[model samples]
Target: MMTVVRLMALALLLACGLAQPASAQVQAQAPAQAQLRNPATLAVEGPVLPGETVEVAIAFAPREGWHGYWFNPGDAGKGMELRWDLPPGWRAGEPRYPVPETLFAFGFMNHVYKSPYAVLVPLTVPADAAEGPTLIGVRAEYLACSDSLCVRETAELIGNVVVGADGRRDPRFARWEAKIPPRIDATARVEREGETLRIAIPLPQTQALGRPHVFIAEDGLVQYGEQQAFYRGEDRLVAVLAAKGDANPSSLSGVLRFGNSGRGIAFTAERGPVGLGSTTPLEASNAPSIGWLFLAAFVGGIVLNILPCVFPILSLKALHLARAGESESAARRDALAYTGGVMIAVLGLGVLLLALRAGGEQVGWAFQLQQPGIVLALLVLVTAITANLAGVFELPTLAGRRQASGSFATGLLAAFIATPCTGPFMAAALGAALILPTQYALGLFAALGLGFALPFLLLGFVPALRSRLPRPGGWMAHFRRWMALPMGVTALAVLWLAVRIGGWPFAAIGLAIALVVIAMLMGAGRRQRGGRPVGGGMIAGGLAVVLALAVVAPRWIDEVEADAGVLDPADFSEATLAQAKATGRPVFLWFTADWCLTCKVNEKVAIEREATRDAFADAGVIAIRGDWTRSNPAITRYLESKGVAGIPLYVWIDRDGEEQVLPQVLGPDSLIDLAGASPKTPARGTPQ
Candidate 1:
């Protein structure tokens, strides 16, 4: 027992004190030898003959769980770079990289070599080179990364080659040479649209291609992260790639690979049309049926009534409905005229939009609002309405004696106001309509007009609804005065839009014109109240002058604003979105326009709030906003891709690349909750 106790005490002493030196020796010995061995090996693949070319390779066999990069590293990483030290009259060409496999890391896709790969470099031996052995040296720089960590590596390489000898090529080098892409004589055409480049390569019609991918050779010309879409044509293969960095390139050279075949053809691009005209060639199988499109258009028009832009006009019309106590036949006649007005306005605008699109102009819903003149015209019209509603002047009654003409004009105004506020259901139908056959497209627009007129049409035919309305009385006068408030607000909103579209000079001039028109309206109202005969003619002349001035003022102000050359901060684009996405974090996208009331309201109440900003910061969310105040093809194409008809588009892309689309009308809490940092209770941004 005493002997065992003495042994235990000796073991404890060794464990506590004497083990430190032994452990240190083991760790020190193990690290020195491992660190000295390089992970890569450099070799000369062929004997360097006098005045002959030879090949050299820098081969890497990575450690377990680590990998190196290809020529175009993709997303994030550094490709191998070599600085060659050659003798006099010796030259080194660009390195030839083997085809790399796709590896994903940290929410990014990387082109990497996971196991073993070799990069070959060509050397030119001068005619005057000596016959003895020559020393070739290189310094290589590269990056290696595992799933969790990344490390940069630098290697110094040296190799000896016998000059003036019969060169024997390495069989291993032959294997890598076979993997190099062969240059093809195929015709390549490239078309540029916004930041996207579309390349069309003429492939033999008889050949069948399965899942082809294009690997671009030039750096800073294409975004490596966005998916490249390939479309097979009868005799051509087309690829759509996102462009980055430089806009102008002499040629785009890339390798086109078929799935897993280790075979590809490389070609340089030339600028020309691919015979596609203006329409994008999408797969026909994914298109919705015509019936579904019509239904979507109808439903979208119905939803428009609830939009902020249209709802206020509806409120104004509701007050007018209370005074409809005329004979049933007369009331029905006025309703039909109003319905005709709304239908004509919608159909006419649709025709104009289609005409412009057919003429190769890129336009979409509420495209007229992009015109400063049209905005200013609408402002004048709305201002006149506000004055009339405020009892500045009584509009002359139509031949029917109940302002049937006024009802028709109101319908026209309502249709105009409703154009800017596109809802969810409208997006798909309208997007398809823009690209569908002409007759079918027109039919969709007509259906939308019918839907817009539905509510008023029902009131016209249904006598019961009219009977239920309150009788006209002294209360209407008070209501008309109150109604002017919203109308006045609408006028101010238009003036604000003018400022946004043009500048402060435009707004100041517009406000001055509005005040002048108001004075004329009051004068006419006084003259009519005094029983004067010529008051109506003066008011008519004044309205005409107001319209003329509003149209002409924009040209003058545009020159000045153009000279000032101010930049708007909110015009986020696809390139900006791409940059934000490259961060491997969440992104919040918002599309808005100067004329969209709901967009403005959402911007103020939800997007621009301090809480929302804080939530976004906490969640590492990047906020990007797109401005659609003008005709922007890039923005239009982006909207089409997402099936959005107009502004107030909210898109949330998470870290894992899943997308969530938020509602057009949003509250601060909706975005705040969505931007929360909890992964377990991740906020869903999809529209309800």
Candidate 2:
């Protein structure tokens, strides 16, 4: 009865981007000149020698709430336009700006100077001429914005510079030069791998980086808001950024900020191999330590045992325990074998995941399920196991014999199936593992396996726990038969998942193959019951049919369309997300996959409810859903930006540009409360 209760619980548990054009030219005459609260003043650092250059600084002192744009104002705002009125013999160079801070507003990332800042332009003096004072003038037009409003402001300023030598030099030029990022001596290299852009800048490994960030000067080269991944080699720092648009340029210029030390270096990178073979991941300053990550992985593995997705596998383990408990040595042997099997499977998966990422594949945890071939294989295996548990034909050794190998195989199957569910604490560890060094990541995987096997291991080693189990007897046979129910449900679930991942025709072929194998197995069982030979011909025929069907199934496979949900969310892409957020409405973005059990549970419990739909309607929330059942590079990049390795991620961006990441496990009222808190506002026009 207890087995049936556990089985019942197990049954319940089982159940494109587009390129954006370059920034448009902002017409200076679009808006009337407003009050110059954030005003610009011009000055010259003078006593300029003939044939030499003198620096002219255009300084702006913005009000407390006002800010001015940088030379390359990120997503919105206009860069300063300066028309120079210089002496006939003099020439002005391109303007250089200091590293600017980032501002995210109305779904746009703006590069601006919040406080006092300066733009320096060098003035070249002619060799032939003037020794007296020369008049220099510039008409500076720029956009200044506050949190809620923006204004176009223009200033015309004039300054004097002595060409010969009696004029005093401005002392502030030294400070202003310090603000500009100095050009690095060594050239950098950048490579675009699919949707990712990797830039390698030559910097000594000894140099400390606080919170490094790369700001590309070229418009539409990379996504301005995506978080970057940094790595440090012996003499170079490599930054991985998400690429935007379809523009492929030969060379790129960017500024690399060395943390919060107010120091940065400007570099130009050519298109080439970034050759940073082996490097250490440089995490953010506030990231947790390795020990904490290990603990989290271990705890997460323990928690997975209770999750509904793993309950079917647990039933198998329970039956193994019942048989092994009769003998102490047998119990210990089986426990060790099981542990070994689990460790091998988990570590193997970890290595494969890392290897794929290293090879430039954008994939995450349980990536195998994303492939139709793998899902088909899993369906076949589960169906066979279900039949075996239901008193059908036995395999040569695994099903009929009680051997360590059988226990090991069970452990392998358990771990393989349990990974689709990411319990609490697992997300952080796995996310970090992706960026951590290979060895450390493997250690975390090992820790997870040990934790998963710990409970079963203890039962074998500790006689008191073993004694609590019911003695091995006739009940064991009935117990095994009943276990078939959950296994059958599990098989059915896999069949449904196959349909979702592949198309109906593909699933139908797979189902027919499973039935053929079951019929052959039943025949073998009847022959054995009659004390006649279970012919090898029947087994070979079944194997041939299964192999032939598996080979042909891919032909019928079609792209599975996303199921319509209650919220009726638009399909998620980077372009679509930007468009939705541009409307200045609250955005509710969630990512889920068909095979993810936890995501299904969440949809049923929290997301797909009428309350959530009504609340979002009231709040004017734009719903964007990312379906990741298949491999999607855009979705993978977004997940990496959020520092997560798996799905069921919820992001809420309010109308005011405030972003909040809700918990992975959602409550019944989580969406309702979130929507209710942010009242609806009139839709704002998209940023120009």
Candidate 3:
């Protein structure tokens, strides 16, 4: 009986009511410094001058018993790395690294740092350097070592190199910046062979190793994190090149993050085989260790609460708790109930997935969103909840007593809407859950569920936290009444997304049903107590409309695939692109997912508009889209090749294959302009 009650509560909450907002848990745990056996800090200081080649240093701060690494260690060593983000119109000169020394550990000659050593980086300010505050962000993603274990960390360090009005040196820079010597005679070469693109950097001297320390850093060229690099000889540092998918060497080009003395050391790494642009064949999964997989899932789950649907519901919950101002025990009970509700939903999904898999359903991890029916159903649910949240309906039958029914309902509704906002990390985590051994997969999902439920649970268990509340008053009534606007706006937004997916007609139908449902709910509210006649016909109509919608929604959902009018090489057939170039127009390609809120927002207000379409038609532009609703290896490769770590990725391709990947957040005008940039030349070809 309790289970049934819980189920009904969940259904009502998910389908209509606004979510309760719990406090957002910001998990920013400090990475342990004790784990910093060989701590290194790189600082950029100079007698700041315009166009002066100068020195910046990377200093090691190793613990008494632990040590760090040099550029090249004799054997079994990981080099210290520094990555630099420099502003435009500026260049950096490579550092002259201090030679590494070898120490014996466990009967093996391990090259490492026994004390602090300084490796210098030379900065070269361009002759055409624009005068401004030069702020550089440095991240040290280094492998720190101890006798027993190695730790890899990425930490941020910042420095300001001010270019002066008179081109005079900043007194602060004189302390540590070093100038790169002129006429250095070494160059690094990158090449492609069957399974790899190999890079060889000539070392001025011999160093011991099975592999050399190699990093890829090129603007519009080179792959990172995926390439396999090895050292050949003391003077020869070899790295294998792997092209991002469909991104050909006839393709290779994009910003690459490579290793530097401080992390961004400039080595003229070679441009390997132009013919070796596609690197999809070599994407071998080194499958993350089980422990690593669990951690990733947990963290990913924790981040889910920040999604649009989740947060609003959480906000409502916060308001409810504030209203209750109850004891810690009460709060804890509420937390447990809420968390249990969320977990049951997740577990239900898991069981459904497992059952489908058992039944030989060809469903993947994205089975839910991939099905248009599911997406449409979810979209309708969102609309209903949003309307309810806007306070268009009054179902408060326990009118005399203040009940949190609505707040709890909102939280349930939020989970349904939020399911689609899954990020790459979520995909990766869920992928592991689906692919690993049954026990392992279940545990991974369990961890994720626990993580997602943690914040609300925290609210229940902490009384002091609960005591912090706003008393119910006139202000409370006003706030509740006004808060409905955002919910109304959100409903409109979801409706727009539906239109983009299925076209104007589907959007109209879905909307018609929502209006009918709302009108019935409102009419019923306005009716006298215990009187069913007023909204009776409306409710009957709404139910029938809903049943019809359930059948048609999936079909409509399958129709909408939206993108940022950016052009990607992978989306274009080279033959087709050649035609587009002949016309002298650019192309826009947008990659999207159903779960992506930002994508839906962009599609409605920008991409799906007739005005925008007509504008593109006149501009000789080309638009292509890749949807991530279901797994597509082709799309994955295209993204990786472009060096995008994540999506709603928008790429703009000029007539010359000059590409610009836009930001995650898209503006309508910017998207329209991106489409307009690619106009057909005199050889004018029709867009694909």
Clashing pairs in 2: 211-259
Clashes of 1: 0
How high is each candidate's TM-score? 0.56, 0.61, 0.45
Q: Cα-based RMSD of the predictions, in order?
A: 24.6, 24.0, 26.4
Q: In candidate 2, where is summed lDDT lowest over 10 consecutive residues?
A: 16-25
**lDDT of the candidates, in the order given:** 0.68, 0.77, 0.51
lDDT of 3 at 122: 77
* Better candidate by lDDT, 2 or 3: 2
Q: Per-residue lDDT for 532 in model 2? A: 92
- Clashing pairs for model 1 are none
Pick the lDDT winner.
Answer: 2
Which scores greater on lDDT, model 1 or model 2? 2
Question: What is the TM-score of candidate 2?
Answer: 0.61
Query: Which lDDT value does model 3 have at 571?
Result: 47
Candidate 3 lDDT: 0.51
lDDT of 2 by residue, 1-688 (tens): 1123223322332230111112212433333233465688888987888899889999999988989987777766667889999878789999998878878765557678998888999989899756888888988888777775565677878888887878787867766765677564345789987788889886643233557788888877787777789887755789998888665668999888755544466878888887547877786322346787899889888888876658657557767777666789888988898888899989998999887775446678878789989988888888888888888977632462468887888888888888756777777777667767678789989988888888888888999998998878878888888888888888888888889888899999889888987888899889987889999999899989999999999999998889889988889887777777778889888999888777888889999999999999898888889999988867776665454678778888888654566777899999999999987788764322
In model 1, the Cα lDDT at residue 670 comes to: 86
